[model samples]
Target: MSETVPNTTAPGRRSGGRVHRLALAGTLATVLGVSLVNGVTPAGAAEAPLSQSGKATASSSERGDLSAAAAIDGKENTRWSSAFSDPQWLQVDLGASKAIKKIVLKWENAYATAFTIQTSSGGGQWKTIHTTTAGKGGVQTLNVSATGRYVRLNTTRRSSQYGVSLWEFEVYGTGSGTATPRPSATPTTTPTTIPTKPAPTTATPPASGTNLPKGPVPPGAVRVAEFLAECPYTHRLPDDPIVMPGLSGGSHMHSFFGNTSTNADSDIKSLLKGGTTCSPKADLSSYWVPTLYSDDKPVEPTGTTFYYLGEGIKDELMAQTRPLPLGLRIVAGNAKATGVNDPTSSSRWSCLHAGEVGSSKNFVNCPAGKMLESYLDFPHCWNGKDLDSPDHKSHMSYPVNGACPASHPVIVPKLRQVLRYPVSGDPARFRLSSGPGYTMHADFFNAWPEAEMERRVRDCIRPIVKCGAGGTP
Candidate 1:
């Protein structure tokens, strides 16, 4: 996985400057009912439903049966129940900056007595727009004025011991109406028109072939390898011990696959000796990520396929790639960072045969008989020096311009991880144990026998052959 650099901008500047502008714009749109910016109608026009399209999350769920997305699913029968505690919150990402005018909450038997409606340009700092301490357990239509990409319901006091539950949490707004209004053009007696210049175009660098394996392709050769695994759900654990020490269970929740014994005490030696839950019994590696919960129950994947290939590499070049060494560990994607409205997030949600790929911000809904899918692409270039890096990410990097960089010149097989869950409906009702959908990340442990892995890479992966157990396509 590629390394991420943190943004060092001051928090005060972000909240005061950017947030203030959004608030001002939202207020104007709310009063006008239909506001136009940049010659286009905003998202809040006609009082359309906004919450259904946004991603939903919460502070903590009661169990696998009470996911936060349930509240925003537009179905009164499904409800979201938080942990039986104070200071619970339900949040939604509007996908983009929008002008919110109203919020409706349909409460279940368990409700929040004291709550506040808040908005945030990003998901971090929030500004409260409405608060009530005398909330009754029923449907509430609240008129609010705010503009943001994220809206949340912050509940402080529960009306019952059962915790806060909401059958539906609805938000209405004008979408994409939050752009700062452009100043009106000044008219002059001597009107002068300036000729507009064509925008300059910068050519993207072509894919480099420096690291490609020098060879001639065999006749009728095909290049691509895929395998299936019956990945199951395991307990959530802390980040890898080698990467983050002394922080057992400090990281977000994760659902382990393959090696069932993975935990805070796990190590390379333990993984090598541990038995696997996967088929073929010979494969002993462990793989895991934040567990996905729907309707408060853990949802496991079906028909999951793992694709191995060299990114943009020809068959001859792919044949030269080395197999993963035993005891190798790698972390892909960022779990700590929220992916809401983040287009750069590596996590992608889609459906089988849907032909459309959705990001974490706006997840795709699967039709009946179809399945929800998660896709993760791992790096293909390796440094050929260390089995692991200090940060657990530096040892591997993605191909730059379709070629490996000098520091990581060894081309290795790129892993395209696809997981399909058996649940269907609004993607909002689904979430990873780590937190929100955007916080999705994955971990992998190399536990296959050294000889077996090498043989498979040479005979199957290198030639782009699809195979499963015993390496027979």
Candidate 2:
């Protein structure tokens, strides 16, 4: 454990507790805080740097004049002075041989806007790992990855600036460890329409009470044709047979809020609630459930990649002032798809953004420059076993259909590497157990392509999937 220093101000800086003390001028809010840290110590091990394992020990160097903003204590946080401006900044040292996968920064009582979290390998070559608006009064966790011995919190909240007043900070990481390389699978030809066919015509009365918007596309909607052009996976949705069956809306087989999928007609009804005719054969749906009430739309038919769509642009725009589709992601690679038999091929798809766009480049704007790590903190599954072994069983591919197998194994040559650390609270990335079976981790299911990081979905299923063993055959 590291020792806490008493509150002491040396000319331009201040230090004491982890939080910042501030003063305001009339209605104009300006934070005045600073801290100068000194003395350096090193973590004496070769384990993952930020695991729940790395421990911090107090330094041997005595406290200095504490006036220089550049003096660092060689750990998770730096001291700042509270007499100068609205926001102050400092950096952290992760030491050598470790690549940071995540960081959780503690906050003081000040509001922050334009602040950035940066990382450097040797306290030199810095990289903007993430940008976010600091949350006041508590802890704000930011996920990021960069090779560096020094991590920094650069703030812009000062007397004349617009930013947050930062306080204490805590950093986390998975020290140096071998990152998992993506495996390769086979690719399949594109489909023609949404999979899973619809049931016999049982048209319900005209949906009422849902005041969903109709026809006049939203202010920032992308045209159907434009959407198709940008999303290559659209080419696969023409008359796909899977949509015909309408199996109980399971995970990706269809859409469901949680585990249950009822025939309340709620899903289909929601889809068509506010939609209008795009063309004679191109009817679009915009509500919760997804359905296309048309026959021959000009754009290629396809199912919505809701998660990606929501994350990339649609959700962001809906939550902001100016609406437009901004963030989009696409992926291409070799991997066996669900319901497909060939394990020696690959496929491609546009996995992100099927909604509207907005003016803001990032998800949220901040007083200091916005921190970028929050959005990049992806939930990934981690299995204890390595995928490179020959005896390993393959996981399933996401968005399953009759053309692809539920799960398929593949191979890939290691190139650029990125480790996806798993967390405890994430339901999307966890381990479960059957009544009499071994614990099953999501990492045991599937993986995304190595070349593309945007298409983050990977199926995790067994090589021989059965009705109750996690897949339906």
Candidate 3:
């Protein structure tokens, strides 16, 4: 289910403006006695990268090239340098309202000596969450308690005479919470409506007699599972270790789920060594897709229900299905072709309230107050020999006429990703970070523990049984 928060702003300020600084400053008076040390939380545990997926802005830019968005662009070399002056600030619109927990500021020598970390709803009135007078130049990791759609670094004093330049501004938290619904909002045009249908309460088991033998069955069987994720947001990196290595930014923008640390300079080895932000806390692998941009701004999903399924073999054949190997990397959907005309496109668009799924090559037109949803199915057939191929895609293939080809004969659990964006109709305003909708692509990294993955695949997936992190559906 989704939870809504009010978007009401204080009097005399527009949504998403920095005009309420005086009001926030007055409110800071009450918390002046609060020690800065009390706001620091232990940064040992890993958390999600919140700032990477949000829209960034600043009070004033030093130049046109160095804009405010650079601070959250996930590039340490690129920075948002403000005009040389006090009372400058940099802020990010998290796309949707979320429960924020921490903020990490990577400075570029020209840092702020005195600043307050503030949050806001509708970017109007702000609330101070953390404040510091003595600022360092390297990095400031502050744990804060605040919830809002916007987070800002309000600098009152600069450490240097140059300006307040930030190499990176990182926000971390469980991206949970929903935006208040706009009145008279329709699903086909408006870009901010939440999904109305709740996910299925119980598992929808596979058809009877579909289960194959106890051991590995024929090469053609299919398997399926469904899971839920809240507030899946965008980050700059694709976490597929084989496709992208060494923490470099992905070729395109990406919407990330599962593992929260996908944006960090990482690889398969680094991912296996790290923890996850998933509910089970056992799924260390990260999942990402091209970021969906509407009206040149990022739009985040409040919650997502994913359908993981395969096609090809019957129930008996499913028994032979293998678990996704550790470090397995798969890329699905074309990142260059428009989603509607690309023959290789696996995405099918639809609307939740419309009660009908659109063609694979067409964008769905939903009525008002609906959501634009996309279903992307990945190849289920995998080669038994290799986890990854040189081409990064040759190891997997789709089933042809209910049969696996000789090249990719091993059947594995297929992933049917159901991504629900806040945007409705109006395809013209929608674009992926890579380009237009046709350039949409997704990446998967196998971070599951070896033994656990094997057990689940053997006990549940192979039997065509629905399952989650723990066990049977």
Candidate 4:
């Protein structure tokens, strides 16, 4: 992936306090009703900032903090709630009334589509403001110059093809007055490239303080290759046929009983658990990585990081619907153990591994009389053993039988692995205003309580910074 330089340059300051608000409206009946009924004001009209007592909270800068009341006025079951589920909502509270220039909305993955942004001076009044279509990966930027204390975001549709999630939202003001541009290196000409092996030993820390994000080589961060190898498996997709990169339509079809789609990039982002993906390539590596690499080496130094491209099998989609006419891909590279008696398989095998299922009732072709091998599995299977079985006590305990039954199939979690870097070029400038580590518009995590956010910063972010600086961890 390409290295991104945080935007050190600030915007030229504009005068006159303009009101603006960003509201997240999920399917919450009460919140959506309140916003829709309020009727938003027209864009560009002078508006007032919201009160702290209102449903939304305020920030001097339009930098979005998901936890802020203003950011999630109408949404329920949000990422912040203990009952967090997919399809949440958020609102933006401009600390005070200020003329707004442009608004940037970022999605965790393409969880939302056909979303609308409305503006309101008082929480009760609203206006139909802006709308957008969604993509499976990357950021979507929308431009609007409106004044209001509150801005509301409502989703007409959440991509059922995928679930819900989000990373950040940012708003910029027109530079007529207070904001001043700092001299930042221009946006790089090349995109960042992904590296398969560990980074070379001689790379130096980025000249800018590692505190600032300026491309892939942060001050002390370990190379992406190292992080990928050591990271834990967070989740996985079904064994579906790969969505071909160029194909314009259709969600993952589960025709192949065991197959699944890795098309959704959000799958990779959740590996950070509460944080955003280490970088944007969490998914979309399928297409981005293939296009940028030649024999596994990158084509660019700073930016050419590949994203997970859609998947493809070089055959009709229906071919994967049944048992393999021929031996299928046996991915074994990430395995951790060995031997018929060993619970963990050797990681060297780079394809899907298979063995006999105990019974024919579970397989369409294999009769009860013969041993069978099918990708599908019996119920409650985890690492080949029935998780509900009496002998299957827990993840920490091994089954009395050394190996799991083939019918009880399990996939090693591969979704979170950074399969490839998607971009190649000089790091792009990420504009930022505040937040402990995020001063620019680079990939960042959603903050937790003060202590949790600080812990992650020290344990994760700081070390990555140090690695980029050519220092020992």
Best by lDDT: 1
TM-score of 3: 0.50
In candidate 2, what residue range of length 10 has the lowest lDDT sum?
A: 223-232
**TM-scores for all candidates?**
0.51, 0.23, 0.50, 0.24
Residue runs of model 1 more than 4 Å from their true location after superposition: 1-230, 234-239, 245-247, 340-344, 356-362
User: What is the TM-score of candidate 1?
Assistant: 0.51
Model 4 clash count equals: 123
lDDT of 1 by residue, 296-382 (tens): 788777544444543344434555677676666666666655455554356656554332222243357777766776767666676
User: What's the distance in Å from true for residue 12, model 3?
Assistant: 40
Candidate 3, which ten residues in sequence have the lowest lDDT sum?
A: 1-10
Better of 3 and 4 by lDDT: 3
lDDT string for model 4 (1-473, tens) is 00110011111111011111222331132233432223443444422122211223222111111123212222211221101223344555443444565554534433466667777766478876687665442345565778765566665565544333333344444322221111111111111121122212111211222242222323212211111111112223222112222232332221110112233332223322333222322221221111122233322112111111001111111111111101111111111222323322211100011111111111122222222111110111133222122211121111112222344232111111121122212222111011110110111111123343232224323222211111122
| Native-to-model Cα distance after best TM-score fit, residue 127 in candidate 2, in Å | 0.8
Candidate 3 global lDDT:
0.57
C-alpha lDDT score of every prediction, in listed order? 0.59, 0.24, 0.57, 0.25
Residue 183, model 3: Cα distance from true site in angstroms: 48
